[model samples]
Target: MLLFRLMSALLGYVVILVTGKATERFVNMAASRGIYLWDITRVREGAVLLKVRLGAVKALRHIARRTKCRFHFERRVGFPFLYKRLLRRKALALGVLFFLGALYFLSSFVWFIEVKGTERLTVPEVLGAAAEAGLNRGMPKWRVEPGRVEAALEEKLPLVAWTGVYIKGAKVTIEVAERVVPDAEDNRPSHIIATKAGLVKDVLVLNGHPAVKEGDTVSPGQVLISGEIPPLEEPPKPGEEQKQGEEANKPKKPSRFVHARGIVRARVWYDGYGEAKIAETGRRLTGRSETRVSIKFKGKEIILSGDQNIPYELYETETFVKTIPQWRNLEVPVELVTIKYFEMAEYREELGIEGARSLAGERALAEAAGLVPEEAGIVNRSLEEVQTGHPENIVRVKVTVETIEEIGAESLFKP
Candidate 1:
């Protein structure tokens, strides 16, 4: 049925209103003459409406005259009529063509370029390399060959181990995998320097000359190991006085330089101070709370759920406001406000001197430990209570945390 309607509309169809005494006879005569008609509806006692293809309409006039009924076209629909109407409005047709042309032209060029999977490399660095491969923005997508672009990017960037190019519509995505090669052994002349000031506990030279030994104090930027290894000098034999002059004359062997590598363990101490009052008074949450939800519209608020009034006298409020997102200069004058009232209770405690000191010591130790690294080995921790000349209600404690860790770092030198 739908296909018949579509074919009828494609060939052009019209609805006709027939009015006369013999309207039923007119339809019967038309059906007998092999004229196709559909959607036949009776509008009134003497009036009838029906649809017929444009070709059958000319033949319907003869049948209408024989049956003594008059008919007139009520509506004309189909591709032919639509084409005639479009021909009348030339500007509309031209605008549609221009829109399609613009859309096709814009979609052919690459507009957005993105780089992914970059850890050590920067975005601009990857884009720069891609631009050198004829894969830059605004270039025609047809001109971009994925295979060539991938090869050029990999060749241009030494760190890129692999690369992939994908073109999806106007956006081109470039994904890269960086090389994960281990650092090679550095044979260049360099020195091991102290990264921080500490008391050197032990110094172990792996590939360079040691400058500091155990129980030595080192400062930041100070060289803990020398890269220049001096040549070993031998003492002269009993009768080798002339040989000493010859040895001095023989072009002295220059000192050998190497990339310094060593581990210098040092003792670093961190200090922190904390104080606790013997008598403390504060307010704390009791975990008993209630939530109230409400909606505010045009300066009027209405509670949606929960109690209208908070039950606690002393409480803390946690309010969260959710508003409808405004769009394009249109603002919604409504908001959902949720308020949580947590019951609070006043707390007062009087701790003796020993209790206060213990609490203050724990706080001070925690603060000092924050400065120590997780990889550092804990050597010692001590706390001391500070006392004033006159008695006071506060107990102040000073804590020290001592850790032993490697402090040696490579420092390049000009040999």
Candidate 2:
């Protein structure tokens, strides 16, 4: 049925009203003569209405006359009549074609450029590098080679480790990742000290005297390895006894101080607290949005399309304004503004004690995990609820995390 309707519309069809005493005979004669008619309806005792293809309209006149009926066309539809109407108004047709051509031409050039994921390097620096590689704004998108831009960005900016270039519609985006350079190592006479309070899990002294052994509890700034190296004492000869005055007469051995280097593994504990409300109320977007576009000229605004009034009562709005560029001393006072409205709804949720506690524990654990070093080995984790004397509507949880990591830091000193 759909295909028949489409073919009928394409070939052009017409609705006609037949009047006379023999209208029924007219339809029957038309059908017998291989003339097709659809949507036939009896308007009155002596009149009928029906539709026929444009090609069969002349044939219907002969049938109508033979059946003593006179028919007149009520409506002319399909492409044939539409084409005739367009021919009558040539200017309107030309304007529509010109608009489409202009739209296609403007879409071929890049209008906006954005840089993402950039740190330590300014946007102008990245753009300058991209421009040198033929990826500038207003350039034809087909001419901007993404591979060439990526290589040039990494080469021109030494700090850029990697880059990604993307072209989407009329906008171009350049993303960059920076390289991280480690500080130089310092080697001087120093001692390795604890940066935090922790229990020593393992101690490996490489180039210094052990100030504290394994299983020892240490505080912040406490020396784990000493830079001072004591001189070795000579043992007494076999069966030889030395007097106290003879030892006093012996020359004193000088203590040597050197740079300390060692690995001191310790169990560091981090505590974090978090709270969640049992009953919470908040507003969030409902994921429904509408856009309104307008043009501003000479301090006046004219709406181009979209609804004049906002449909949502509680909604958030985001707007973007674009203006024509100035050339030489001439500037066009025209800009296009697009405003988007997003619908929002308020919601309330009831989380029981167990649910609230679970949420609070997750938050508390995340906070405690942030304190742990990336290279540290997590040994244990525990979560406990804070008990209060009075009743409250909030659930508070504390997280304690234990991780084994190297806590030895060098502390320099003079002899």
Candidate 3:
């Protein structure tokens, strides 16, 4: 039984591999011969299962003669009677059953959409978006294109700034980011204000009068622009037809509110601290990389790297697959794939202070350089301090940059 099982598995793989390879070679040969085979398939033990558009008979004869194999002609049909009969007889039957079972498992519609790490969004809203993206009830496994599906969902759901989708068997997984609505201004009329102290480098005014101009020095809460202005006309006196009299004739007060739109790049005095430490300290780092390929009926996850020779480490792997619907097309898999990684590696006191500090400084400097604005100037640098224990012992470096840029910004509008 075991031998038969082994043979069955081997035969299954052999058929798939041979069919794939033969189809590829046939394509290449046909292309070279100034012929085009639009469609092709391979059936090893039977008559020509595939009908090639380009040199059909000739290619068959060529292959048969080259491999010392017999060739026969047979009609292709919707129901592969001979193939089915052959497959049902032995271990091939088990493979056939397995393939059919996998197909069956993939047919059910995705019932639940479990979103992880969503704060402002509700579950129903996310699911509704998924439905809009065609990932809802009755969506075939093959038809659920995760990338396309996620994109579509994001378009309709404004709250989700970003999303990732995955499918495991019948369950569809969604990870969502909620739209962060900035705090609104008090209900009363207000003016746009500078959030920090800066010399006005530039100013744009929309919908409100400009209070500060280019080259103006301003403090926090000082209005950069004003929206609300005094009324142009006085109120009606003593209820003399207040609704329809002078009150109506009086031009409405110019609308008062914060200037709705603008970007101000200002040279602001700011302090930034970046620190690096020197020590031979080990730290745990997490790296995420995933690889995927179709295996058997379902897709399997494969890791290409990150396995290290250390004991104080942790590793985790996650896999997901969505199957396609049709089986006749051998080249296209019914299976879709995704892989996730969570790995942790730690280093101990394998080295002393100076070395660790140096490495930390290098890393921190790299980070600082990456973060620095192109036109910004470094105003100061603090000495690297070597301290025991985390972040400090790991490495510490502080850098300060002076730049003309606006950082603290808030919009008074609801959107």
RMSD of each: 15.2, 19.4, 23.2
RMSD of candidate 1 to true structure, Å: 15.2
Q: In order, what lDDT does every prediction score?
A: 0.91, 0.92, 0.58
lDDT of 1 by residue, 1-415 (tens): 9999899889999999999999989989899999988989999999999999999988998998898899998999998888788799988888888999999999999999989999889999989888887887898999999999899888988889999999999999999999996566577688999988899999889888999989999999999999989887766688766656787687766788988888899998889889999998999999999999999999999999989878899999999999999999999999999999999999999998888999999999989988888989999998988878788889999999899998888888788
lDDT of 1 at 392: 89
Task: Give the per-residue lDDT of model 2 (tens digit) for 1-415.
Answer: 8998899999999999999999989989889989999999999989999999999998887887788899888999899988888899999879878999989998999999999987788999999999998887788888989999999999999989999999899999899999986444445679999999999989999887899988999999999999998898989989999899998998989988888889999999999899998987888999999999999999999999889999898999999999999999999999999999999999998998999999999999999999999999999999999989789989999999999999999999987
lDDT of 3 by residue, 1-415 (tens): 5774454334331111123334455445546766443334554533223433222445645654444445344443223444667666867777778999977875566656677867877788877777777777657667888998789867888777888998887778888877777655434344577877778877876555667778888888776766554445655578565555765596665555543445666776543334433334444556644444433343543433333332233756577766666667665644555545556666655445666556666565666567656755555444444344643444555443355765234445431
Where's the lowest-lDDT run of ten residues in candidate 2?
Answer: 180-189
- Model 1 steric clash pairs: none
**What's model 1's lDDT at 38?**
90
Q: In model 3, where do residues sit more than 4 Å from their true spots?
A: 1-119, 125-188, 194-198, 217-221, 227-255, 259-261, 268-403, 407-415
Candidate 3's TM-score reads: 0.32
* Candidate 1 lowest-lDDT run of ten: 181-190
